[model samples]
Target: MSFEDEWAECQKTANQRSTRMQLNQTPDGNYRPGRAPGGDLVVHDNELGAIGNEAYGLYQHLRTQGDEARPATFAAATAMTSSSLSLGSALYQVHDNWSTQLGSLKEACAHISNHLDYSQKRHKEDEARIATGMHTVSKLYDYFK
Candidate 1:
């Protein structure tokens, strides 16, 4: 069979399997695994903190070192512009394009760092709020009992 036919067959099989629980289920109706019945969203504080830290580090590195070649590039472009060679204009254009791309990359790195830091802080606040609500609910239940 052709690649397309094989791919379609695979997709059909996947669709059929997806409709049923393939694993993590026992013969009984109850879930056998230690996990919750429905899908759960879990996040680790350390992992998120590490990602934010790494993004910030990358931002700092890019800000400090990514522009190291700017001076040389500018100087070369200036020299080429001053010269009467036919490639002078083209050289300056290349320099301009490089500078633009470098600036864009620097901005992207900063954005990633800032976004990750914000997400980490917001996640902490959300977790604290959830924990406080749960505790209050548990106390209410104890009083009722």
Candidate 2:
């Protein structure tokens, strides 16, 4: 059989099979083995900070390097179109699409970085507030004692 035929047959067979996705619990609703009783998930601050830093770095790199070809591509497209070559329009379209997709990717990276940074800062603030409240409560109890 040809590659396409074989690929299609494989896809059909795969689709016919059952696919199960269990998150935190088994299909019968019990917690999965080795999972915490409450299925609690933990994330450390340093991990989040690292992820945020990486995203920021990627954003900065894309901002600087992603458009390195734009000027040349635009000039080529303009030259081609001016020369009445139909390929120029296609090139222009490709350039436009690249710019749009690049913009979206950059925005996503920025959003991830900013959100993680915000989350880290907000969590620290919350911890400080809780600690201060507990200290105040302890002081009040001591005064009463």
lDDT of 2 at 84: 100
Q: Give the alpha carbon lDDT tens digit for every residue of 52-142 in model 2.
A: 9999999999999999999899999999999999999999999999999999999999999999999988877875686577568757756
TM-scores across all candidates?
A: 0.61, 0.63
Cα lDDT of model 1 by residue, 1-145, tens digit: 9999999999888766533332223435454433435535455667767777787788788778877877777777678778866676777777788778878887887787788778878866876786577568757756764
Runs in model 1 deviating more than 4 A are 1-39, 138-145
* Model 2 misplaced regions, further than 4 Å: 1-41, 134-145
Name the candidate that leads on TM-score: 2
